[model samples]
Target: MSLIYPPLQAPKRLLFGPGPSMVAPRVYQAMTQNVVGHLDPFFFQVADEIRSLLGYAYSTSNQFNLAISGTGSSGMEAAVANFTEPGMKFALLTNGFFGDRLGEMARRQGGEVVRLAKPWGEPYDPQEGREFILRERPQVVAFVQAETSTGMFNQAKPICEAAHEVDALTIADCVTSLGGMPVLVDENGIDIAYSCTQKGLGCPPGLAPMTVSPRALDRLKARKTPVQSWYLDLQLLDTFYTGHKYHHTASATLFYALREGLAMVAEEGRENRWQRHQRNHQAFVAGIEAMGLGMHVQNPAGRLWTLNTPRVPEGVDDAKVRAWLLEKRGIEIAGGFGPLAGKVFRIGLMGHGSTEDNVALILEALADALKA
Candidate 1:
């Protein structure tokens, strides 16, 4: 086979990385269905169903919820760009990589960005975050509800409340939280939140499921300047998804997969699904502890249930272990990055990938890899 066009055969690996997690069989089947035009009536019906289903996934009734055509970062950019304009003061709470990405997006949009920085793998103190928001008094505030790089879950309620108190619109990066845990957009007062299908939603990576509160939407529509990215403009997306107008060629195959994945979420029941992920995470942690390995996050409550980060033992090479799992065991997992590089292993038990058997398999394989 040519190097550029290699053979289609691929090795099967148990995905335990941070994202692009194992997809459900049902979602795969759904993708094999007939393809329809982006503007087809049937496609519109599917789109409508997806938006409605996304409401259940995001735990909101904001009426402006829809999937962005790009990945989770795209949704993050959309959320940042739509509400923030030139000269606006934007406050970012950064504890991990994605939080910094938000600040970058805002800066690119010509917003004045100020940030409160914390060590990676540590969730911010709610009071400290609130104080920063109030002190900065930014027009827009953004934070990561679930930090993918470090497996930390920051509290959205306090952050959202503080933003509102300062009359700032809030954006939450829920890329790793949406399906595996409780986002509680309405209850948490999250004005805007976005997630990826590949992580908690058990679908492939293409769509970014997003929700925007009326407050944020109003601010977006009444912006003094046009949104920076035309492709990610919420107003245009609103017309495309809700108004049935031609904007872009959205993938019906991907939409089919998303709709089916979301339907599975509905069938499994949101609360029930969250419980399942929680149980699997606890079990996995117990197994890791039993193996004399420690977790990356000190506070158990702040750690992510969907994505777990375990401390790498002294004298053991993290990359070698991950390589062994891939070459010898055909299991795919991830190593830590940034300040966490070579110090932790980033393992995911998200969406369809979360299960007792999978947990046991990883533990056994990792133990063997360590022994090897």
Candidate 2:
């Protein structure tokens, strides 16, 4: 006889981790809508609307805005693979794990990588970045706007200006910032910006929303060598999204989820949503400090409102605390990694999860766990 297993049933989790934050009920409902063909006219209409909403979310007027049919990492790869050519110089600003990953992607694309290193849990100096860009004169400069690993928020305007000064394209990893904070791609002069459907968008994973400025498109058009990744090639992908051409079998359900999530963002208004994240972050910080815990990001201005990294108490085991919270309270919080492993806990308050009730609940649970 075949072994029997229960039907798929997932518990209700209060997601307080770095990503895949709590999805809104409406978004879940939308995902259950009837599936449609990738090339169906109605699905194409959904794709078009997503492009416009993504433009609003990113605060950009770039014409190349579209959602890649993968996670945020796919967006990262697309940004690097399309812009980087063999022997082309690429300057990467490394202040955390994601920045280092960008540098690695650039290197794999055959670009000569020049990493501008900064300590984790710190932000980069604009002047230093400008000077580095001028000295290196790399063809592309990339940085993470929100460093989720250490909860550091990087300033984009200075970095973009610096890259533009030397005619280098700017690529911003807005994975943890978009929808939760002000990306303002046009105002910041970012040539390319990429984010995911999860996190601040309050949607499921599998969609990477991205936009590319005209300057970056011009450079891509002028490139002598073809882009390496066929699946992520912008030239081919554009035809499918922009024109009535077929590229791949895009998931209609994921698009439905993203569209509903974007609708929620629009309903709340961007500024209001950002302020909500900020307020919750402040409250969380106050609670953490009151419990005698410290934050990983020392500089107030460098702190990411979406992802807060609180230092693990000296005597407590980080894993034990996280496990206890999950088992006893059904709360899902993540521990830090890389240099911050066993040193800090990453608690995210983003999108629908960025609420007063959730903040209070997490803080109470954390305090109890610490005391235990």
Q: What is the alpha-carbon lDDT of model 1 when measured against the actual structure?
A: 0.92
Clash number by candidate, in order: 0, 0
Between which residue pairs do clashes occur in model 1? Answer: none
List model 1 lDDT by residue over 1-372, tens digit each: 555975799678789999889999999999999999999999999999998999998889988888889998899988988888899999999999999889999999899999999999777888998899999999998999999999899989999999999999889999999999999999999999999999998999999999999988888878888887899988998998867998889999989999999999999999999999999999999999999999999999998999999999999999999999999988888999889999999999999999999999999999999999
lDDT of 2 by residue, 1-372 (tens): 698988999998989999889999999999889999999999999998888888889988987888899999999999999999999999999899999999999999999999899988877778888899999999999999998899999999998898888999999999999999999999999999999988999998999999999989999899899999999998889998778799988899999999998888888899899999999999999999998899999987789999999999888899999999999999899998988899999999998899999989999999998877
Q: Report the alpha-carbon TM-score of model 2 versus the true structure.
A: 0.98
Give all candidates' CA lDDT scores. 0.92, 0.92
- Point out where model 2 deviates above 4 Å: 1-5
With candidate 1 superimposed using the best TM-score fit, by how many Å does residue 224's alpha carbon deviate from the native?
1.1
* Model 1: lDDT of residue 16: 93
lDDT of 2: 0.92
Candidate 1 local lDDT, residue 215: 84
